[model samples]
Every structure is written in structure tokens, then in C-alpha cells.
Target: MNDVTSGPDTPPLTKALKETAHRLGADLVSVAPADRWSEPPSFDTSTVHVYPHSGYTPSELMPSTHSVVVVAVRHLDGVIDSTTTDTKTTAIQGNFGYVLLNRKLNDITFGLAHWLEEQGYRSVPLGSAGQSRYNHRADDDPDILSVGYGVFSLKRAAVLAGLGRKAKNGVVASPELGVRMRLGALLTVARLESGPLLEGDPCPPDCTICMKACPTRAISLGGRVSHLRCFTDVGRRGVRYEEIKAKFKAQYPVDLPDVDYVDKEYWGNEGTGNRMCKIACVAFCPLGKRRLPDVMRRVKEFEQQRPKVELLSFPPSHEFALDAVGEGNSAAEPSGSG
Candidate 1:
């Protein structure tokens, strides 16, 4: 697979499509085979109760779905850092990584899907963009046709795509971008090359910053998150750090755990509105906090504070991201990321 055979192995079309994704501003691009979704989802019902929206498999949506292409792009920095505050206007007020980023990601998938179709492969873009393009009648809803369909879950698709591991915060945390990212997908019959799953834990051992920082206490230690609390509470009322801080202090431990508060970036100007969650999980997480060197330094610090769990670096960095994909003996692209 690493040899780039481009015929029955690497496939030139796969490489070309990946390059196209990069050119479209995608930070990471990976693929997952259709069979992956066909398998029964395996997870502990006791600790993990999340049933991602719909349960439809890729094959059910598109019978000939040979591969699923997943792509991720970063939001403007500082959105995650704003988790300490109740209001996060930095992202809502027309920031590149907010609504605009989602739209752009949709565009990328739509374009890729169109490209796949041109190559005689059927593809369906998964996102909210223009529905009219795929609909024959104006009253028709592309909900299951053109919109984000065919995948069981986008986050899981991202994990399968080999971009990164799913973090404790419930979002797919990329080594390069952390949780402050927008993900998009395209279901295609084309068997594009895939990447490997990122190895190791994204969070440093003993570092439960995200679970601890959650304003609503929605995230559990066992990784079960209350999506209702996160979306409803945070979106409707906003997240206030003082509330989270007070709760933590009330349940004080031998020594108060160190909680880092980062400055919220207001690229769209400060105090826009307190509509969304400040994204506390992303704010305190050490991953993607800085460049690789800076992130490594923090990991070393964590290793000292908590010696039980070993701390390490997130692999498939920019230097090796391209190479990481298509590395295994199966396809030119990675089976997962790192």
C-alpha cells in the first residue's frame, strides 16, 4: 500500500482526491471503508450511552459505498480558549472557523462528491449547504439524499478516517487542531486510500481538565456525556466559569486541582453574544494548545505532576501527516492517522 501502485493498490484517483482536499483548505483528509459501518457498533452501554443521532449504515444509504472520505479543518484559534467564560462571541460573530468554516467544509465535500460523480463514481456530500442542486422538485428535501447522510456518526467517521482519536470531550480531537475543528464527509463508491488510527491517548494521564471544566458537569469520568446538558444548557443559557469553579471548589479534594484559564480571542470583537458554549473542554486541554514543541513541554510537566499515567506526544504531525496516510501495506493512504 505504501508503494503507491495507483491501480488496484494505492489508486491514483485516491491520491489526486486527497491533494484536491488539501488544495481546498482541508488540514486533514482520510477514508473509511463501507464495511466498517456495517459491523455492529461496539461500546459499553453502562459507561458510554451515546447513540449518535441516526443508526443507518453506509451500505444502507449507498449500496455501492466503497469508501467514505472524511475531512477536517481548524477553527480560528482562541475559540477553545474561551471555555472559561460564559459567552463565546469570538466564534459566532462571523469568524472564519464558525458558521463560515462549516459552510466551507460543506463546499469542500460537495465539490469532492461532484468530482467523484464526474469520475463515474456515485458520491453524496454530507452537510447543510444548498439542497436545490440535488433536488429535482423545489419542495423536495435532500435530507437523505444530498444532506449529511450515509454515515452512522461524523465523529466516528473522523476517527475511522484516521484524523485523530476521539477525546473525552466527545469531539474528534486532532493532534494538530485539537477539538476546535469542523468536519465534513462524502460517501462515495470510489475506494480511496485510507489512514491508520492515531495511537495513544490524546489527553495526558491524570489530566481530566475537560471533564472537570465542564460548566454543566455533562461529561462523566467514564466518558459518558450528556449531550442534552451540553447543547441545551450551553446553547440556551451559556456557560459561566464561576459556576463551574464554585462547584469544583465545593467538591474540593486534598489539593485543589490546577485549572488553567486561557484568554478568549475576540476576532469578531468582544461581547458579541453569549449564545454558545465557551467550549471549556477545548479550552483547558493541553493538546493543540500550541505548536508541537510547546505541547511537548506541557506533556513533560504533566508527567511530573501525575506519574501514574505516562504522557507522550501526539503523532502524525505536519511533517509526517502526508506520509502517515497510505502507510500500511494495504493502500497508499493511511488506514487511520498515526
Candidate 2:
């Protein structure tokens, strides 16, 4: 049986579930059979490359997993249309407002999981790399932590669930929202009928506009992206972002002048290096209305001036695969060290 199907009918429960997701603020919702994680269609390596999986399936999180309920929420207009350096720490990285969108999508995931549980089905809410506790004997491994674990690839799950086409810029581009969407999922024991993959690719053939627009040169052909360079561009390479922010808040006295424009040495007295990138990937996408024409033009111009340095993928992903599941590894073993 195919993991994704083009069935002419949606099952009754699946139909009601879609309505519930929308009512709870999900802009898009679809299902992929749990087994889809095990065998990607035609063994497409692109899906596995960016949203990689060393074979962690929904069943790792939910032993009885039957379907993965993928959900997405479009990014706010204020975030998508902001200037390259719109202040206030940008929320996403050094200069992006990604938190607002994440909160909404996570809420939808939480809501759907709760709804499924009420229906007597086991459900695990996968909001931004859901956690799974690991078995740890204090006698043998007293330092092992069971919390803050994250693994399930939400992007890969979105692709499997038929949310959007994985575009050249390395982001899934939905028909209505382009790449301006955040994703979350629910692993449920309920057997929801799956949706077929989106019908067509939004990216044009021979078009490498997004690749050219990237200042860090992170994205390559076929969606192979360098997570290291992408993270490094925003100064997310060696430091914990939340820790830096906390330090900034703890040290700065509100009465100080020009608090917002303090140099990295002042606010980030601990040598917190924070930089930003114009979201050229989304802004330059020739897709939906989310693409800001003026921003695209600026990005194109900046592309020519910026230095091009290629980057490689980081922290080999295989260690997180569920093959280690009953062998004592969490499906979410450990987040790759940035």
C-alpha cells in the first residue's frame, strides 16, 4: 500500500479532524501514514537530505502510530515583509520575527493532539521537534537528561503529508503561502486516510533565483542545504540564542541610553555574536503574494556584493535514527549541537 494516496474520498473521521484543525487555527492539515517515514516515495533523497531521517518513524514516538497529522500556519505579514534589519532581535534568529508564527502553529498541533486524545486515540503533539523521554539509570548515567529532546523532522513529515512542494530554496512552498509557513504535527493512533502529494512543483525549471540570492550560499540544487552555514550566518553557530538573550536582559539596566543599538561587546558582554540575513529565500521566491517585490530587488542587488562561501552539513544525522529505540535511544536523542 502507498504511504500517500490520491483517494477520491476522505474518511468521516479524517474530514472532521481537518475541520477541527482549521477551527483551531491551522491553515493547512493533512495526513501521512506512519510508515511513510520508513520508505520515502521513489526513495527521494531530497526529502531525506534537508528534513533528514535516519529512520525515525511516528511509531517511535507513538508505538501504535497509524497516521501523522501535519499542520501548518502561514507567517505573519509583519514578519514576511519586514526590512532586512528590523530591530528587536528578529525573533527567528538574529533579526527575524519567527516566534509569533511558531506559537500559532504549535497551538494548532497541541489542539489537534488533545482533540484526538479525547476521541480515545493516543496522540503526541509534535510542536517544533517534539520530545520523547529516554530510559536512563542514574547509577550508570546520572548525567543523561530525558527532557528537551527533539528529532521528528517536521518538514519531512509535511512533505509526506502533502502540504506543499519542497522548493529550490529548501523550504516547502504551499500553493497559497509559498515558503511563508511554519509546520507542526500530531502523531496519532487513529487511522486517518492520507492525502496525495501536492500536484505540481511551484519552482520553475532552470530557475536558480533563490540559490543566487543566498548571501551565505547555503542552498544548492535539489534542496540540499547546509544547516551549519545557515545557522552560522545568524551567529547561531556556537552560542545558545536564548542564553545570550537572557544574559542581555540580566545585565542591561533599562535606564541606559540607546539600549537597542548597543554593540555586541556591550549588550552581549559575553561575546554573543549575532548577525542577520535578509530572508532572500522567501522574499525572492517567485511564488505567492508573500514575496515582497521590493525586498526581492534589494536581495538580488545584495547578492552580487556579498561574499560567497559554501558550507557543509553538520553533526551526522544517523545517530538519531530509531533503530536504537528499544536499545535505549530516544527517537529524539539529542539536538545537533549548533
Candidate 3:
């Protein structure tokens, strides 16, 4: 009744059924007990204050409803890589890659929802914040109701469903996708078994590729991030920083002489605000390696490639958490203007 028992029919019933769903294009699928989803931490204001990415509003419908179904759609790393070489390509790919992947995830969620509904149970699909047009400038005041019933964020739902633990980068990485997968959820009142979260830092301790690769130094040694700095760097030119600046100033004449204008002007002249760091860091992680040493080697390769900043990206002792990069307890100045 609770867990799927392995009776003769059980093997055919559960394994065959789940495999068929995968054949229908579900990348990573899990059936979590509805109880596990009750009181998701995004609803906690304190937790939200600490982690701002959770959608602003809490859901009233799905939490009270039933069983939670979650799915992951693998993001195409090839397309993500194309963003680095060509700016036009980066813009085009970055914009569409996330969109396309999420759509696929939604489609899968809908497929699962309908499949569940056919079995005489009601179902709901988790909504996306990036898809919602509401102003999220106020991170604390998210429109939870607009996100609506049955839909859960890939970020929050993944951790709660026991798929994976949260990373310092604030992404959910699995042995399968690392941080490269997109998440979607389905809500149903049905009974199903859930998988256990993978243990330890799928990322190794010696691996600091993401940190060293960050252009803005947005990733902290302690696994903390300064989002504003990361965005500003991306917005301005971290990629073709100098090239972007020249193109922008040529396109527009500047008359104002304020700090904001100056900053804008500086960013315009130099192509300094692209997410090169994020691209580089993620592209180089050891997750895809055949062994931990391979990942560690990749991390070292990144460290060697990095230009020495005041603070270097170092590995955390524990697999799951991140610590700042330094010898003892010394802290570096926060990366950017948040």
C-alpha cells in the first residue's frame, strides 16, 4: 500500500509501467509520497530570505491536494556551450535553451498527469517562475497563487522529493545531469514509491572548476554566491567585455555623467557582462568523469587557467557544502555590488 511490493504483478506493474513512461520520453522520473511534499520550505519566510531563488508565492492548491510526481529533462550541454564562442549565438541559445528544455519538462509533466488522470486520479503540473511575467523584483513577495496547483519548482521539488540535495550554487545536480537538468512536477493523490537522494557531493573536494572559471568571482569559497555581482558581470561583458563596450558606445551617444550612466557606459563600451564564468565553471565540473581523480584533474586544470583573483575558488571539505577559498578563516571582500 505504501511502498511498491515486488509481487509477480508488481514487477510487471511497476517496472514495466515506469519504463514505458521513460520510453515516452521521461528522462528522470520518480513517484514521491504526497506527504514528503507537505510544507515545502519555500513557504518559510526565513528560508526564502536565505535562498532567494524560490518562487515568491506559496501554493495553496497542490500542497493540500495529493501525491507528488517529479520529472527531469536533460538540458543539452552542446547548445549551452555554443553560447561562449558566438555572442549572437550565446544570446540566441541561452534564451531558447532554457525555454525549450522547460517546455519539454512541462510536456513530460503533462504526460504523467494525464496518465495518472486516466487511472481515475486528479493531477496538476507545476508552474514555472521564469515563465510567469509577474515582477519578481521583490523576491520575498512571490506570486505563489499564479504558480498555482500541482506545479512545483524543479529546484525546491528535487530536494524535497529526495532526488538530490541543494548545492551552494543553488542548483540541483544528480548523478545523471549534474546541474544540467531542468525540473518539473506533477501533483496527484495516488500512492507511489520515491527514490532516495544520492549520497555525498557528486562533485569531488579537489574540484574547484566552477569557482575558478567564474569571471565575476560570484561563487564564494564557502558555497555562497553574490547574485547581483554575477548578474552585473553577465549584463555587462564578462564574455567579450572589451568588445561589447566598443559596440555599445558606437551605437548610442551618452550625455549623462552619473555613476549609473558611467557604469552603463563602461559596460556598453566593453563586452564585459556575459556569463562566461558560469559557462566555464559548469562546463568543466568532474560530474561527467569516469573517476573522482579525473574530476579533480579537471578542477586543477581550471585553477591553472584562472587569472589570480584576490580570492581563489577552493574546494569544500564536505561534499555537499562550499567553504570560502583561503588558508584559515580569512574572508575575501564580497565579489560585487549586490
TM-score of each: 0.60, 0.65, 0.60
lDDT per residue (tens digit) for residues 25-127 in model 3: 7677765555544454323433222223343222354443444666776656555445434233344444545656556666666777677566555667662
Which clashing pairs does model 2 show? 90-95, 90-96, 90-97
Which candidate should be chosen as best, given lDDT against the real structure? Answer: 2
Error of 3 at 70 (Å): 1.6
Q: State how far residue 265 of model 1 sits from its true place (Å).
A: 32
How much does candidate 1 score in TM-score?
Answer: 0.60
Give candidate 1 regions above 4 Å deviation: 1-10, 40-54, 78-95, 128-152, 232-273, 289-338
RMSD, each candidate, Å?
16.2, 14.2, 11.8
How would you encode candidate 1's per-residue C-alpha lDDT over 1-338 as one tens digit per residue? 12112467457888889988898878778897766554353433243232254434677667778888988877654444333333335444235545677677788898888877776778888752211111122113212211121224677677766777767666777878777677788888777787765655575555555554454545656454643244333424323432432332232221212523212211211112343435545544556644323222232233233222111221111011111222111221112221
Ranking by lDDT: 2, 1, 3
- Using TM-score as the yardstick, the better of models 2 and 3 is 2
lDDT for model 2, please: 0.58
After TM-score superposition, the amount by which residue 9's alpha carbon in candidate 2 deviates from its true location, in angstroms, is 12
